[model samples]
Target: MTREESDMIDHRRLGRELDLFVSDPLAGAGLPIWLPAGAAARHAVEEYVRDLERRAGYQHVYSPPLGKRELFALSGHLGYFADDMFPPLRLSADDEFVLRPALCPHQLVYRARGRSYRELPLRIAELGGMYRAERSGVLGGLSRVRAISLNDAHNFCALDQVGEEVREILRLIREAHAALGVRPAGFRLSLRGPGEKYVGDDAQWARAEELLRAALDGVDFTEAPGEAAFYGPKIDIQIVDAAGRESTLSTVQLDFDKPERFDLSYTDASGARRRPVMVHRSLVGSMERLFAYLIEVHQGAFPPWYAPVQLVLLPVDAGQAGAAAELARRAVAAGLRAEVDAGGSLGARIRDAAHRRVPYVGVVGAREAADGSVSLRLRDGRSVAPMPVADALGLVGAVVAARSTDLLPAAA
Candidate 1:
């Protein structure tokens, strides 16, 4: 590769070097398999996101990847989004299931089941799987994939609660982005363009756009016409890669149409049934796309909390191997991803840890091991003074707990 090409921060290349993911012809284009290391990081991130949603009062739910053909049809996906969806699976003459292209259809049904004014702002979330019929040309690594696991949520709320709910969603998005080390390239207010195929009428679209605009009152964003979802306008969080290509990583969309199509309603005060507006949101869009951005941005050196291997212990010789093993066990027991590397020379093992982008490389030698202390070599190339293994574990644990981007302790 030429210098410029070599310098490009491509996740595909990094992913291979780090053994994060792989794609095979048999698996088909745009479908990348997450290797163990990749899966571990993804699992950590997914856990964090789920807890975040739970703390934010979101009720999590699970749904099958595919749904009946009529489900998407009623949600307008079959009518407007079928082109991007896989062909239906025909189980029989009358039974056809399409790999769902979106999760809102099933999510809308969740709110449609009797709700009350007290549940006016019912927030439902799912890290659910869906499929996309992406063309081969646009398919590459995890960034653009056919199979998607989306961090999707929908808030069913009365009309008056729309503004506050939207603002709070934006706040949650910001918090998630900060924790994930995502640097948004820009914010976009995607609106409906003239003559475009859309589900809702002009007045509804106008009102939705106005609500988004008000929510973005203090934020600077560019308006992109013809970029809105078929149902409503959205605020798309964009990210630019090393190659300067932009893609949407997260979004908060306001939908007043789905409630109408799904006939979603809630009992208000005085026994009145009123329609609820759907606020569709995603803190991080999809696991595939999120990891794609994360891999490229961090250059395989993920933050310690979600790093594939948070710590690797390297013993100086066989004499220190026992100490290393003990430390490894303790680290793992404390819920840190750690291991011992004692097969090769200490220098070689250290280099391999660096190559693998391990956040912490613990070096246990005779004296240090005897004292129950270890020296740490950080991924960023700093060496820490020999410290007790317990202290080291506690330091790492604190970093993980705070979700801080810094690898070194605050005092350090």
Candidate 2:
């Protein structure tokens, strides 16, 4: 595909062309329908990140989509993020509930249930669908949406352990980005300024900002005063898209105020109770935004692990269909997402695979049938020497498993 064609295969176009997903104008606009392909992509992303989170010692937790209005009120969202919250849903029991705009408060309440200093640093993660109110103008495709599937998590750590936890989370984020091939550039430290725009005691804000700054001392960052959240300062990872737009991809925030507001405490080693510092971190942010950004960044050519179909088996004609199906089955059994493309001419089949951004294409024909071998083509049209079906599948599997795009020959 030419540069023009690549650009045209961006998020919006790919979402429509591949039938991966669609935003319905009639179904309250911002909500999107995840067709099979889109859902598969989301599922792959979730599984990948969930595995990483588990290895990083994060326990998975589930929370309700809506909670009492006072939940956010205690978390300070009612004052700071009221504009982004959905209006309260009045219950028949004469109570008020609002769709959760964030997952922090529910997790905090869970942490507050009871714990000793032995559980000093509790890491919990959730892949939650959260809703927030947004005006029609700001709602675009997945890039900017009112509803989001967030990879939200928080760590409640004793004050002394905060720095090491931040560093470990940063490493995890880097590993996740490396897997997706979208490594972040650097951090943006959001700090507080003296103003009525923020809440909380001035001394707490200063102390919290200083702690975060110290944590980020050696890291690269652009400090932005007056951009801090009302509860605390934060470090947002920023990335530049293919369209050259700079966006915050993920964040790690340090908060000293919420524990006080919620009256949270944990027993210390000295047998005394103490307030634990809270860190809110989301490596991929919302899946919705990340998918949109990745589509644009890679121009719809996803990496091997993330691609819907990593390989496709193309038969020369109906005569070779049986062998092609066998190869497809083998590819699937090898843990690769694959299918047989038995329609159209050889050139057309290869072109289709290229357009779909598949990493490998295996062509089976009479020669391969007779010799029990198959011709392999890197999604680029260059012909790889004919190899036994097992060998070809093994090579492709290795490439996918290692996420080594270099193993794929350049486009022809």
Candidate 3:
């Protein structure tokens, strides 16, 4: 589609029409509020990512969004990364607490205590909040937000285990992209460029770059000097927007600087203390940017699994209201998102459902209701013959469970 065509279906328009999110001036620029529908979808994605990390052996933790100014100083944010950070909130002359711009500092503190080789690969993950002081002119919808809820993680591993840990993170990124229907524009090896202010020395940078290169063995990527994080190099997964603009959607970075700065150490096999490497990675980036891309690419018809309302039951008249309500209750009991809309005419309700981008709409007439069945109407304009309510719900559940991109099960 042309850029104009894509722009017309941008997330800003779809978000308004679908009630996904809203940005009000009183709430300040760049801080968008998630409405109910958007909140439900975001919650689903958050649950999926947390579970994915847990199954991958990551221990989740909660961290505050504010920290002492000294914390960022230790993380090198004050030195090389102050432009994007908000001004420090001075509680007193010596007790300033600033909103965090990154989670690495907090993660490093988590590993501050003594550790052994057995915990070499301590994978810590969080779906937490951070704030960036983005310029007002750059703030638009959910794409560029001041407050970001990030899906961030940090892995502290021994030097020998860095290669495998980075590669495994790449695997997780690919799986998440497939499940979320994210089409990567390209992959990038972000590195330090000439005259750029960076934390590590030449030897450390070279070693980090080499490790990242080795990890991208079978993958196609381009070198993007000057795009790497202040501390080290990263593998950035890029996504194109409705305007054909490309931005990072996920990433895996190699960091040797943080461990040294934080003095993180682990006991080696020979009873010697050793420094561990910190690997920073985000499987799906931030929720705001993710939804921005998802809204535009899918045109608000999100995949069934993450769609706000999976099924809407429309009863033909008052007689079948009971039947529609019963099916909706059953769908909820089955851990599916469902609702009954009996306020409008059959045709009107169907059109409304289509406008809302509902995945499945079950139309209940007298005969179908009497049989405890429903004629399923899909969002793609396909209609199924009247089937048992249980069977209809099963089809949806199957697609959701498989995280299939298709609205229907593969066999169907």
Best by TM-score: 3
Q: Rank the candidates by lDDT, best first.
A: 3, 1, 2
* Full candidate order by TM-score, most accurate first: 3, 1, 2
Clashing residue pairs in candidate 3, if any?
none
Each prediction's whole-model lDDT (CA): 0.91, 0.81, 0.93
Clashes per candidate (backbone, < 3 Å): 0, 0, 0
Give the clashing pairs for model 2: none
Model 2 residue runs over 4 Å out of place are 1-10, 183-185, 407-412
How high is each candidate's TM-score? 0.98, 0.92, 0.98
In candidate 3, residue 187 scores what lDDT?
A: 96
User: In candidate 1, what are the lDDT values of residues 137-229, reduced to their tens digit?
Assistant: 998889899999999999988899999999999999999999999999989999898775788788998899999999999899999999999
Clashing pairs in 1: none
Q: What is the lDDT of candidate 2?
A: 0.81
Error of 2 at 150 (Å): 0.9
The better-scoring model by lDDT among 1 and 3 is: 3
In candidate 2, residue 305 scores what lDDT?
A: 72
